[model samples]
Target: MITTVTLNAAIDKTYVLSDFQLGKVSRIGQIHAVAGGKGINAARVLHQLGIRTLATGFVGGSNGDFILKNLDQQQISHDFVKVDDESRICLNIMNASNGESTELLEKGPLITEQQLAEFRQKIVLLGQQSRIVIFSGSIPAGLSTSVYAELIEALRKTNAAVFLDTSGDGLIHGLKAAPFFMKPNEDEIAQLTGKRPENETELVQSLHQLADSGIECASVSLGASGSMTVYKGTIYRVRVPSIEALNPVGSGDAYVAGMAAGIYQELPIEDCLRLAAACGTANALSAHAGFVKREDVDAFLKQIEIVQL
Candidate 1:
């Protein structure tokens, strides 16, 4: 089983509009409220892929209850630690007029020290049972950036592979533990390496730097163009097929889920890159957050072109 950890889970509310005018009223084209957070998304994708997954994390209050109910209805098994404070809500405003999306996010509930310890214990117990543990998204307040790093170290002893997808200090600190896999978009990778890839060769070097840091596999998303992954000192570039792109919000999360799927199956390096890039492209063809259609993924899987760098 794969265990996904969402330290700062939220109820993702998406509002779609034909066109959004500045400081003006806009009619809602559609609206969707779903269980969200990076790890939650990964779990949903894994479950859709017929993979047995257990999602564990911190949640609280009514919003938290709503998330649990939704997951339950979806038949996705989860065991989130309950806290006194309320969890957060993330709002996404997608303007179809110009194909743009703006998001407003809330810092999640401030977890208490006792709550922290309980969640930590939960993770360890769950990690012991799972073959892989996925750690993703931002942490709530009242915790240090080293939380994931510490968790990685602790879980590594259990022999379960760890994969992470997060940014900023959380990612910077977590790298010290050397996870099995990490998926950071191009900008995040540039921020960490202090170098932006101006061309394919530079990009390959940057990915190599990450793999040299001891991460078994490292990947970066290149928005619409595609993505790149490095494994065991080898770099692979995945070129995504062009399609009518709708939204790019959750594609990165989908990519992470695909990577987890590949690792769990022990797929070849090229196949791993293909699956990850295909899943991301599939997610972009829809307006939903962290979602993808199997038909799209399968069709796009054949369209992906992977080249060894």
Candidate 2:
């Protein structure tokens, strides 16, 4: 089974408006809310892909209750550590006419040291049962940047391979644990290597540098342009066909889910990249975050082109 970690889970609400103008009282056309956070989003995608996934993290209060209920309604399994503080609520205001989205994020509840310890113990047990343990998203307010690194090190005792998807210092510190796989976008890649890649050539070079640092696999997401991935000392460029994107919020998480699913099935590197790209593209076509129909993935898979770089 795959285990996903979401330390700062939240209820993601998307408000669709005909004309979302700032400083104006706009009428909401529609609203969609779901259990979210990078890992939860990925878990939801994994579940849709017929994968056995267990989501674990911190949650609390009415918002947290709503998150759990939503997950239950979706038939997604979860085991979260409850806290006294309320979980966060993130808003995505979508402009229906222009297809543009603006996001307002909240810093989640403060986690006590005791709660953090309990979570670590839980991960140790979950890691033992999981084939792949994914650490995603930001750490909560009270946790240090080294949290993922610490957890990854603890999970090292288990047989599970670690897949990390995060940004900033969390990504920097998590690198110390040498996870098996990581997917960072272009800007994140620049932050890690301290060099802004001018083009795909430079991006491939950055990926190779990451590989040299003991990471088994690394991929740099290029939004609509697709991605560049490196596995087993080889770089592959993934090309995704354009589509009318309804909401692209969780495309990255969907890509991670697809990659993890492929790895769990032990598919070839090329096939894995194809699946990952297809899932990401499929996510853009959907209105919900981290959601994709299996048929959409299959159709997109046939259209994706991967070439060796």
Candidate 3:
């Protein structure tokens, strides 16, 4: 089973509009809400793909209860520690005018030291059930940036493979623990490496350097251009067939889930990357977060092109 950790969980509110206009009245076509976070999205995708997954993290207040109830209804198993402050909410505005999206996010609740300790205990207890641990999203306020790093160290004791996806100091500290893999978008990779890739070659080289930075594997997601994965000193670029794009959000999390699934199956890195591209592109053709269809993934997999860099 795969375990996912979402340090900052939120209630996701999505508004679909016919057209988003500046300083003008807008009509909402649809509204959807769900329990969401990067790790939660990954776990949801994995579960949809018939993979066993367990999600855990911090939650509190009415919003937290709502999140838990939603997860329970979805039948997605989760173990979250209760806290004092309420969890956060994220607004996803989908503009039909140009099919663009704008996101407004609230910083999550501040986790107390006692609450964090309880969370660590939960992790220790769950660590025995999962072969892989997925660490995603940002750390909440009042938590140390090294929180994931510390968790990585503890999970390492069980010989569980840990995959991380985050940015800034959280990523920096996590890297010190040397995870099994990481999937960072291009911008996050640039910020971490301090060298933006102007071209494909530069980008491939940058990914390789990340592997050298102690991570066993480093894959960079390039949105419509697909993604690139570096493994065993080799760089492979995977491309997805273009389609009528619906939304770009949650594509990265889908890709991570795909890759994690492939890794768990012991597939070749190239095939794993193909699965990742299929998952990401399938997500782009949907409206909801991590709402990619398995049929779409299967259809897109046939068109995925992979080339060695």
Candidate 4:
């Protein structure tokens, strides 16, 4: 079993418009709402790939009710702890005319100390049974940046591999726990290393330097340019063939899902990168978050190229 922890989950709502103009009336072509947060997104993708996943986190109020129902409709198993505060709603507005997207995110409900203790207990129990325990997304209000570090430490007795995906202080603090894998962008990588890479050469070098800190694998997202990763003391560059992307949101989460799936399956490092990139590309080609038709993944899997650098 795989356990995903989303400290802050939301009712992710996406709106599509031919042209989204500020201070002007524009008709929306479509709207969709689903359970969301980085961990939730990854769990959805994992479920789509036929992986057994249990999503655990804090949820509350009517908004939390909506999230649970959405998960039930999708047949995804979730074990969320209810709280007094309401969960958040995240909005994604896409403008087809400009090929741009604007996001309005909500800082989720603050968690009480008692709620934090309850959630931490859940994490330790779940981690013991899970093969991979993924901790993703931003830390909500009323929580310190070191919260993940503490949670990770609590699960240190378990054999599950930890996958940490976060930015800023969350990522920095979580490092002390030494996650098995980490996926950070270029800027976040620089922030950690305290040096800005001048070019791709420096970027790859930075990735190598990070691995030296005891992180087994470090994968860096390069957006449309694909990604670079270090695994088993080898550096590789991943590239995906071109495809018209309807919506690129959640691609990163999809990538994490694929990587986790690969790790769970004990695939080769190259195959891991191949699967990860394939899922990310498939997500970009979809109109929704955390969804990729199996056929689409199969078709795109062939176009992905992986090379050791």
The TM-scores, one per candidate, come to 0.97, 0.99, 0.97, 0.97
lDDT (Cα, 0-100) at 203 in candidate 4: 80
- Tens-digit per-residue lDDT, 1-309, candidate 3: 999999999888889998887699887889999888899888888988888898899988999999899889888999899888999998899997798999998989999999888888888778877888999998999999999999888887675789999988998788889999998888888877888888998998888788888888889999998888888888888888978898878899899999999898889888888888899888889887876789998999899999987
**Order the candidates by lDDT, highest first — what do you get?**
2, 4, 1, 3
Candidate 1 on 1-309: residue-level lDDT in tens? 999999999999999998988799888979999999989988988888778998889999999999999999888999999988898999899998898999999999998889889988888899989989999999899988999998998897687899989988989988889999988887789777988788888888888899888988898889888988888888888899988889888888889888888888989878878888888888888787788889988998999998886
Question: Model 4: clashing residue pairs?
Answer: none
Better of 1 and 2 by lDDT: 2
Q: In order, what lDDT does every prediction score?
A: 0.89, 0.94, 0.88, 0.90
Evaluated against the true structure, the overall lDDT of model 3 is 0.88
Give the winner by TM-score. 2
Best by lDDT: 2
For model 4, how does the per-residue alpha-carbon lDDT over 1-309 read when each residue is reduced to its tens digit? 999999999999999998898999988889999999999999999999999999999998899999999999999999998998889999999998876889899999889999999998889899989999999998888999999899988989999999998888999888778899999887888777888777879988888888888889989887788999998678899999888888888898999999999999999888888889999999999887788888988887899988888
**What TM-score quantifies how close candidate 2 is to the native fold?**
0.99
lDDT (Cα, tens digit) per residue for candidate 2, span 1-309: 999999999999999998889998998889999999999999999999999999999998999999999999999999999999999998999998899999998999999999999999999999999999999998889999999999999998999999999999999999878999999998899888999899877998999999999999999998899999989899999999999889999999999999999999999989989999999999999998899999999999999999997
**Which pairs of residues clash in candidate 3, taking residues 3 or more apart in a chain or in different chains?**
none
Provide the lDDT at 149 for model 3: 92
